[model samples]
Target: MTLLAVQVLMWIVVGAAATGFASWLAHRSYRRFLRKSRGPVSKSLGRGDVPTKLDTLIDPLEAQFPCQSGLATLLDNADAFAARALSAAQAGRSLDLMYYIWRTDVTGWLLLDALVAAADRGVRVRLLLDDVNVQGFDPAFLALTQHPQIEVRLFNPTRNRGHVVRRTFEMLLGLARFNRRMHGKLWIADGRLAIIGGRNIADTYFATLDADTRNSVDADMLLVGPKVDAVAALFDSYWNLGLSMPILALWPGFKLNRTAFRHRLARHVGSAPSRHYLARTLDSRTPEAVLAGRLHWTDKVQLLADPPDKAYGNHSAAWMSTAIADILTNAQSEVRLITPYFVPGQAGISGLTALAARGVKISLLTNALAATDMLLVYGAYRRYRGALLAAGGSIHEFSPLPKNGRKRDMLHSKVFVIDGRQAIVGSLNFDLRSAFTNTELGLLFEHPTLVADITGMIDALSAPDQAYTVSRPDHALQWTVARPGLPKLMYVEPEASKLQRAISWLVGLLPIQAYL
Candidate 1:
């Protein structure tokens, strides 16, 4: 080789070595900090015998159900938020909350204020959040810990707490560990009532986002019965896991002014929009309806959860996905699945084809390429779309446009209804990530009424105006848009531009399906 080429190659090798060494050093520093700042592990479990208003209200209902679980579906965004806020407001003993994302938006603040008010009323509050999204809110979290009645913990936190670049570097260095996140969403009030499902603590999930921004159509379940104990147990297992670290230990130096925080919360609560939203939420009277025994009661409720060890890459024990697969495998007649991201690998496709061979009908509703937020996941899903369609399965892709005067552009609920007799609802998306990578939780029940309710929701969302039907005929793919007076057909991904389709095609060539 020429002298100049040799010199340039040597410089490139040296630069790469330097970069690797720097990253290693940074990771080492983070490890040392974690060891030095580790706090005492939590010993608190879910309070079961606490005498609270929730118990007074729900005890009689439970007695009437008698070993059965009572569930109220929160299909409307406003009612979902209202159920949570009202539950928290009425908790007289303890409140436990776990989520993957808790935005600091209008609705987020309102719920936080509710929790704070509950704490002030002598209710013990425990907040467990995944560290992946709480990078910029350390100060507020730490301040929350200042309340004697409240505690804050982060699941699988990163060592770098300063900037996004540093956190990204840490994640890249420890990709395997960082990839296994806590995706379960649960809210337990006084260990007697709970809410579990796909909605997160954010304005978009609650449909309070601005018109220009897209909102999510999600689902959560208001649970009251013997099954709540299982939900609380799940929360305690995750809350007391070694992977959960207290926020105070992570950011000991950062502090927000307590009085200032209170003032800010009060100001927001007094705002006109907050007043209007809160009024609407209260007017829903969800908690009151639940106390009035207006819920689907059944004794066939089962809790599906991935063990806390799954976060440490242990998939040996029975997983929630396996249980769900078993339910699907035992389907007698029909199955309906609604998921935001549908990257069904070979195994999933094979399972569906097997069901189809048995003369069982299968219907699926997932995000269209234009509606999906993750383009890479969409690319992977497209690979299996044709196979699923050819296997005698009906597929409907959600449209991003407004539907039924509601500004819903994204489908975020994870639901499965089987045989028109049973249903599973929670945060388990039918994808590789949810199946093997992340921890998920859900409620499976054999109540025909609840199953029918979820089935109705699926039917409405898959309507022609709201979604496009995908079919594979004559050895080609087609999307049939049957909107009112706007019937159309397309061969490529509907509503997607040429550049977007090209990018999805390019992404499909990469071997990153496992991450999606």
Candidate 2:
């Protein structure tokens, strides 16, 4: 054989060996991470325990405001923030909070301080946060876990732990595992009062809480009565399950001293900005009224939650979306949907089309291209805009922040109202991710009063000032937008820049529809 041929063969063999070794190393690392799983533990709410601390504060309030069954009050974005703070402060026994994103911003610190105070006062606090958004907030979480009464866990956490660089590499290697996420948002205080819906712990979500209108519009339900217990049960199921792991266990480098951690948190809480925000929150008198059981309640509320295994591609555990689909399918008169991301896959499109064909007045409200935070999701959703509009349904896209507001505002609400009598409010967005790859939670209310309230809110949001009507006129798509107390204007369907439209077009060409 020729010397050149032998040299070429040798180089090819060396390249193959290196590739095989690298693949093996990645697989080995993944297995090592999986081996740390501790399986499920038998933790529960410790039912029937005598409550000396909680009863002292809650019992009298319950007596003062009694409900026939479950009572639910619709809390707009700002009011919901006040309610959560109040619940944490008034808690005697426990506080359980689970959310998809708990940003380490002003709002996050304010709530964290409240929880820490509750824990310091002997109130057991359990926080279950999703692993996807915890990249930059590792120190905050590690410090939080140092408190004796506070326990922190991340649901389906990344094996790379808090490091964003390593987590990105792991995601590239483990696409399937990284794709699924925990999308539920919940807050349960004293195991007696619960708040469930779309608001996460972020400055953007609670923009109105600090009298800041520069955030997204979200909704949550303040629930009491027997339903709180059911929501607690859902929390337990995720907390004790094998998929969740303690933050300390996942990140071995988190060795901050407990005393120093507490002091640091206290110092930050006592800072000027935090103290000012706290004073304002307290001055609102909203907390006082909430603790006194002044919220209006309803009689019937059905809790819908997706199991943690939904992140493992388990379709059966996607109960929130399933229930929502069933509700739309059974609608008699009208179906109104308000969601931030609306990527109606073939099944969703068909279902809604069938509903519209049955003479049901179907209306959809979602984010416009200029207002959406996710471009790929908007790309997938825009493909169906014409089809849905052609099927005798109305589609309203939220406008970007008006020049009068502080910053750009987006529509982050997930709501469904049917027949003016039944409504759903929760964290289940009408997108493929929420339907197939994320755990979600929501409440179905059949009370006429609450449904009417939601219906009215929907009417207000659907006004021309808040959203633009997307219509296909003269064989082309156009958007009609109206500013607050101003004349209406028209534009193209996307209302996006040329480069953005080009990127969106490229994303649309990919064959990952189910995942998008």
Candidate 3:
């Protein structure tokens, strides 16, 4: 009897210990989430500066919906419009443009020529871009800074103008305090219309049939109405506050006048054309108003944003993920996701697993080895092959190198479509870094025809013969299968290479994955 009493006591003690450990772990996890959630972001501008009329601009967004009066999708050539947009600024009463990176490729030239023309015509042009990404920018292109009407600035330009070693260490040690990019890709024209979305200023994004061989698709939106002013204002604030070179500072010998040029350029811009500018514009406000316009949305959707943390009362990443979760949680049928980077941590996998367990079709389309720019990210991504495949999620890898002669292109579009009802394609990546680290943007469209169009475009991209898929049997020993392919297409361990790849890989291995 005494032995029995002791056994019961021991069991009770064990249960308490287990509960304590569980409680401790639960508390730790909760703390971790809180750290990530960080309190709501403060507004960029104080309440005194808040535009009371900004809400009035939202009416244009409504016109974009098919039913509600918002934009459907601009099936136009993004590059051509990009050319027009840059040129339109030459006629600028005022032009504000911002981007993460502006490569000096053919696409860059098209954009640059337009801007220079605008400056020559006398427009007030503000150009803001990420200095880190533009490290190797062409010197000739950099010379364009000498123009009078334009104010060119870097988001966080580094002082180490000499060696790769110093610049790299600066990036690594976090010495580049402002290294965090202004990820917002925006173009505001005369404060009347704007273009915002996932495409940075580059050629791969425009994907012309002539220039694009692989035929990877990307999307952006042209917004008209009151919302544009707010976007324009955001561009202005960042531009005015960002880094600048006082002309003579960068080029003491070339510049003769600053004020005269500014005055003269302003006059020229006034003489440029506005009626000739062309781009798609989206808007519609009330549900009733949408019907009156003969516009119809594929689904009832809400436009949510990070807003200036304090003003919008949400983090950009959380708001975006919640939208994804809402789609996943409420999905009655299938979930189709098209993201360039398919790196999802534990929570993402679990959410996908839950949906798959309930007999829903879950599928993903992302970049293959040859199709990505960040190979290490793909290296990190390859680690989850087993879990994702085990969850009954079928995957397809896109090959940037098309069967045709088109130069291979990384599949850079970010798209999320739920049950064929609604879809989003914009600047947001599925990775955690994009969520918490960068200020991202994208448009969510609700028209079924638009959804179908996006889905169809994805299907065409996936139709290529050589896509990587994770089979259930393969998932059984998937880790082994995923291992061998690393060195072939990825930069897993290392083989010394030229500066670019080597640096990218070393940067990839740093402990600061959260900051990437």
Candidate 4:
């Protein structure tokens, strides 16, 4: 309580306030600059002026299916990568891609090379990426925007573009704006074909990494029909959003070294893993099969997408979750839900329990603690286990182990099957984030073949050896693993270490479920 001490404390408080005010002012100015310097709005080349190769290939299918969309499910990792690569190779007019994550790894490099190759063949390429994970890849993206046939944009980018610490600080300061990300994934080629699903551009996603590494078990649907025009329109909406800032405008003085970037990408092609993956991708017959009019044609395809305004805290614009809820509400026989992260709030639990009470067989599949990448989300999910089980719902947790000689570390596919009649395949996870915080996309179709194929895959993944079944028998939670010799039951989370369990328990006590 001395005068000197009080003066020192006052000065310290003043200095802190001044520093905070300066930071806030800088962030506000940066936001204003981004808004004023956004790139011009551009729309997709809906039905291109010229006849593209894709047009020649899909025109026959269009004639046969009439108003239906040609759909092919991509379950294998190699096939998913092949669909994108081969489609890009065949793209003659324009290619529009939007993703939440596009890594700078092996498969990522290969895909970028494919995009560059398509650009070389006079294909107009537009890439819109969520800026959350685009850190440390700016040089490559900058080089891409230099190409005459290519344009790159980032959604909800940070003001600080250099150091990770500064970027993190900026994100923390603008948490409200930065937290709402564009989580949808779509790839449209020539306005004739589109790939929509949960797979992002990465080595793990395509299984092009080392055998020891854990790969994502994902799914995508390749569509070659009139419905692709709708997909293109959706891409145009996101591309033209005010939040989509052109990379060139963000870094005005950054010079592009196209030769150097091309060389860097070329080196990846020669690597053993890249070469092996490229061979498999090139050998895939998916593109040819689509071109040959061999696909499941369905006229009941519906595009479920959240508007770009969702990123601006517009929860009313979130229609994907609402549509999915309606599907769940109308379920007649059975429901199958699959996602990597599953943190169903009280409302989801209540709705699901109500469905179960109506004799609807509810089966849920999600990543086990060891198989999941997000430990905190897994912890949040654990809180709802008992309620779901009490409602007579069966929960299957995917294990991070090799299933039938294939290694899968996580279940990255988000799917929902209703009454064995209709299915949804897309990036919308059944979580609070997907429901309220982030934008998502999906295809709701009633094709018997596609629905059966998806349900079959779900059945395979839910088998005893591949996943662990959780039960609350005798008022205690236990995990049952149906091994070859005998069934094993454990009280704690399967395959998770003691420290991990402790951390998850601690995380569950936090009030951060809204962000999960």
TM-score of 2: 0.88
Candidate 3 or 4, higher TM-score? 4
Instruction: Sort every candidate by lDDT, greatest first.
Output: 4, 1, 2, 3
Better of 2 and 4 by lDDT: 4
Of the candidates shown, which would achieve the greatest lDDT relative to the real structure? Answer: 4
Preferred candidate (TM-score higher): 1 or 2? 1
Show model 1 residue runs off by greater than 4 Å: 1-50, 284-286, 290-293, 403-408, 484-487
How do all models score by TM-score? 0.92, 0.88, 0.64, 0.93
lDDT scores for all predictions? 0.85, 0.77, 0.55, 0.87
Which residue runs of candidate 2 sit more than 4 Å off their true CA positions?
Answer: 1-42, 47-69, 162-165, 208-214, 286-288, 291-294, 400-405, 484-491
Ranking by TM-score: 4, 1, 2, 3
Residue 368 local lDDT, model 4: 89
TM value for model 4: 0.93
> Which residue segments of model 4 deviate by more than 4 Å?
1-27, 284-286, 290-294, 403-408, 484-487
Q: Name the lDDT value of residue 232 in candidate 2.
A: 88
- With candidate 4 superimposed using the best TM-score fit, by how many Å does residue 244's alpha carbon deviate from the native? 0.6
**lDDT by residue (tens digit), candidate 2, 1-516:** 999999999999998897667657876776666556543363435535667444565566567656633445545555667788877877777889999999877768889989999998988889999888886788889889878888898887777754668777767666777778888999988887788888989878865334444578788888767677789889998887666788887767668887876787778777776777667656666544655454555566789888777766666824778878887888998999999888878899999999999999889999887788888888788677787888889988886545454666788989999888888999988888788888899998887777877778777777876778888766567777665554355555445687777777777677666686
The sequence of per-residue lDDT tens digits that candidate 1 reaches over residues 266-379 is: 898888877887887777586676444458888888899999989888865589989988889999999899999987778988999899889899999999888888888988
